[model samples]
Target chain A: MPNATVAGITVDRNDEGFFTDPNQWTEAMAPELARSEGIDELTDDHWRVLKFMRSEYAQKGTGPTVRVLGKTSGVSIKELYQLFPKGPAKTAAKIAGIPKPRGCI
Target chain B: MTSRIVILGGGTGGTLTANRLRRLYGADEAAITVVDQDDRHVYQPGLLFVPFGLAHTDDIVRPRARQLHEGIEFIESAIDHVDIEAGEVRLGNGVTLGYDVLVVATGARLVPEETEGLLGPAWMDSVFTFYTPEGAAALGAALATFDRGRLVVNVVDMPIKCPVAPLEFCFLADWYFTERGIRDRVQITYATPLDGAFTKPIAAAQLGGMLNARGIEIVTEFNTGEVVPGGRLTGYDGREVQFDLAVVIPLHGGATYVGRSPGLGDELDFVPTDEHTLQSKAASNIFVIGDAANVPASKAGSVTHFEGETLVDNVRRFLTGEPLEAGFDGHANCFIETGFHKALLIDFNYDTEPVPGHYPSPVGLPLLKESRLNHLGKLLFQSVYWHGLLPGRDLPGLGSNMPTAGKHLPVPEKD
Candidate 1:
């Protein structure tokens, strides 16, 4: 598998499967990767947005625009930007492992 | 040359700070300029209630540029870098904005792909998150079709915006599924990396008891490793839980621009901010607030509200060559939804945890205990958020410092 490193952190191409298949992205794997990235804790707002992004992709087949995504998640656009400054399309897709998103790239 | 104040983001912190400054300083004294890539301003707290159909997506959004005071100039561009020594901010558009003072409120970012397999094929199929309006609507649709099986809500990592929201989702989900008459068919699970449901022990005990009473499964210290497709979550310990639908909270980091700005932020992009002063450790001229500051307080709207007062004062101090006010008490308050038409309220700061008592005064709304009044307070805050919070108006009796008068003191145990 081709490997990529972001800011010195190694990311394997096989890791793509981690987000692609719901069955493969297990709770056990999330923290290991997070720890490697140096994230030590999980907050409820983080889960709310991540879970919402997945559902949005499921029903709409695409991530919501930053505006819509923020509203749906109950996070104001200011707050959403505060939470995901890259915008919802990129951040949500990245976390959901859905690709760079069509318009974002 | 005109004295310049450069704000890195046009979100809550930037908007409020600019407006408040515009109110505090004459336009000629300080040329306030706010930079952001887009003009869309979202009502963030509304996202949590969207999936449950309590709020419409359109109701919570507005143009970013419109929210600012008349004197503030909005620059629509992404920040390429901040040259702190030169006292200038370089934009992606090639413009250099020089400033006498700067506010770094670019805030945090969510990176779900940081987790292995989280962004894969089944991302939106059986897995979801509601931090966005689109995610909420999609979750609403997914929940509509879900008839039965295990439903798990997991948090990947912390320091996210609104620390109580996921718990609210769990509580509301219980109400949502029950209303659909499919509550029994859906087994609800709450998983976290913490040893308890929350960080604060006292609040965790209270909330943990409520979850237990609701028959919702609580899986503590379950650090997630990956999301196995087909609804199973694998933990760091190799233990796996199967689910029909999985909700995930991904890892969050500070804005990318923070990394671009030398010595401005941490390895994770969060700014090395003074907890008490809200000033960036890298430079005295730079200040931070909201989700961007790496303070050990709950990253909620109330924290920003509290920080706003102290931050404004400190900025004033910085301009006047006065001693920077080290007055921020890490005060953070939030409303916790407990389902079945009730909610709980808690207020605390750095040295204190949430305790059961009345807030503001000894006889006011109950705190650290469930009541309908708190639930109404949560609902009312939405309106207050739009009208009161974003506008930089001070909420009556609710200031930056947490009032200790009405809170119940921790009971001492016999040694």
Candidate 2:
């Protein structure tokens, strides 16, 4: 089976439960995921932006551009960069548990 | 650090005020921050045109933050409460933002639950509202399938956003059914809480006559109590009006956070603001605008557009320790669509109701009379709202003050 590496954290492709059911993604695993990506701590703003990005992608079937994401989330571009640091499209997509958005390379 | 200017509710009022303030103050002097729960800035007026296929849902909506200036910060969090004495705002995420001046531009919310059985099993399938984007889209679908039936457009209560919208819906529904070759199959009824077709006597007479000529039934003084699915609309007086499809304007209230803040808003959750000054009655540094304000004026976008100029000036005064200027005179203007490629324009303020005259001048756009010229003006305003109104650009001769040039004033009877 192929494994998916999101922000340096590996998840087995056979783990259908976590992918299908968002409720299964617990907070205890958040720290481990963040640590794998070399992050220290997650702020309330970070969680808020991540949750919003995930829901938007689920509904629209497309990841938002930085402009659309910032506008819809009501977060400023500078603040988004400060939280993600690796760029909003990449970092937000990774944290949101979605596949990497297209054209990021 | 620069003085913090916090504006609540990033709808029409917050977006326009933030942009106008950015234009007025330099970045070093004042820092503007706008906070809203969500970012969808729906073009409310376009909701009226949606069901008639005049506008698609995408044409009217844009991201709320896209409308603001780059210097202004945007916060997407639910407002928990306002500490007026501390001059700080509390968010649901446990973050407190301090501000020197606050603008409560939080627009009104549609309280469908307020009306009994309005959100019951038949909601969105049989009954609907066009106020929200989702509601408008659903209503568009329902309208398309409605080839023949008793199509009833009812207003659940007053103080709704865009008071003329329900009337516009009726006119457009008439036009739509006719264009679909189902006018004979459809029976259109307009139910209102007012005694006449409209609030103003002269305008009501004019509009009521037009509705009658079009064969649209008018049901006045109807205080809608419940929407019984199998039954009909049960009024408070036990009167029932049966219909195959019901388009109801549910009760509207200010933001839920307004109710949470003590002494901040009225029973309707609307803030008690001085109609002229736009200052909140609860706090000196706070001001309210748009549909959130419990002022005696039409809750329409044009009112917010007119109030934008005065509100920016008052916010500046509040910061500099100067008295607020009483400039906003309940100025509201609306383009009343009368169907069949025609619309009517009305311009007035607190001291005046809609009077028959040319707007801006004695020979400009004719008011209170249907014309194709007004319909073009209505279409032109969508662009004006995006480029001019939201960006805080001034329109020529269209100031905050209501013009009295072309109106017909009643002369006092000689003794």
Candidate 3:
């Protein structure tokens, strides 16, 4: 039930920093979240992937799979790996201010 | 009147051994009964993936009794003791079943509490092990938020199941963090008691080189003493390593019941057997497989697969009053999953160490080298276990005896 304050915004986060409630996420917090993830800035490509993840989670209630990330987000798999080095699906889900992606990576 | 073969522990070792022996001996010839404390048979290799979120517990578990062939009777109950001399096993519920041939395949037991301060303050909160399903699942949550700081994979002791598993965790961690774009923020370290990254000298050199190239630090000969505060792991000799999150493989011991069956096991309760022939030194009629056998082989599933053929062949010889064949050769192989869709495999035996070569055939999958194709093979092994291995079907090209056709054995220097 813990929450984190980032970019002057309050949002619920677990000890591991995963969102306790996905609905609490805000687009304005993405940059600060990116900074926390060690990315100083989120470029157009990063936003493209992050937006796709957030939108999919909002619509279908599940994050995008890593397999379809590059194709759907218009980013190459190689480039996607470079964009989200921790893992495209899990890391992007975290930075997008959504719940941690589930299932086998 | 049929001979009863009571296999203790319905694990990889017991399941395959029972199935293979069942196929060799019909219902009239031998009756196979597998006894275990629980009916859940876990695909232990998948435990490594659970923490990384690459696998689900449901996907890896199956009813142990269901996995057994129709002929093999499965007893889902606790084992009070094994009357090895009396040739019968007593279940916790007071039932006794005698056996002409008893296979001690209970496998290894993880003794996490054996380590100091491991089960203390930080247990499962920060110090998690992927050896068990609960541990793996707990670590999965921990790994999700673990971004920066030292992520240490420590092997507290040796002779553990899947000896290379801890090393694999380190490699996968690197991959996991690298993908998150915060790889630079996190540091990876593999602290082990062994002299190098691996046991075999040849494979160790290559694997050690890989760890070095990946910027993963290797701390050798570290005998872990305790888990101190602030994520510092102190060794017995006062050496220390710090980690924000620690993945530790605890000490292993033989099944507790082995201690009850006097003279049936080693000091650690692991059955002492011929490394070449899995026949227990305690008794000729008793055989051992997988983690149960104190053979100089890896405690991996591949070892049990290889041991199956030899075990069944020996069972036939035993029943017919023939000498057991020493064909096992301590053959063992495992696929090391590296990050970035790549994996490395190593195959070796008692005398030979894993070196650069193609496995199975000279042109087969590359050995002692990392590749994506090998990664595919690693992923494919799960289905192979369910469909082929547990059923006792021999894989084509791959057999019990290790093949040397394409293996690059180093040449000895002449004086």
Q: Give the top-scoring candidate (lDDT).
A: 3
Worst 10 residues of 3 chain B by lDDT: B406-415
Q: What is the interface RMSD of each candidate, in Å?
A: 17.5, 26.3, 20.8
Give the alpha carbon lDDT tens digit for every residue of B86-184 in model 3: 988888889999889888899999888777799998998889999999999999999999878888999886678988889889899888888888889
lDDT of 1 by residue, B47-96 (tens): 87787777888888888898898989999998898998998999999999
What does the lDDT come to for candidate 1? 0.77
Highest DockQ model number: 1
Give the Å error, residue A60, model 2.
47
List ranges where model 2 is wrong by over 4 Å.
Answer: A1-105, B412-415
Error of 1 at B55 (Å): 1.2
Cα-based lDDT at residue B110, candidate 2: 88
For candidate 2, the C-alpha RMSD (Å) to the true structure equals 22.1
lDDT of 2 at A88: 66
Displacement of residue B314 (Cα, Å) in model 3 is: 1.1
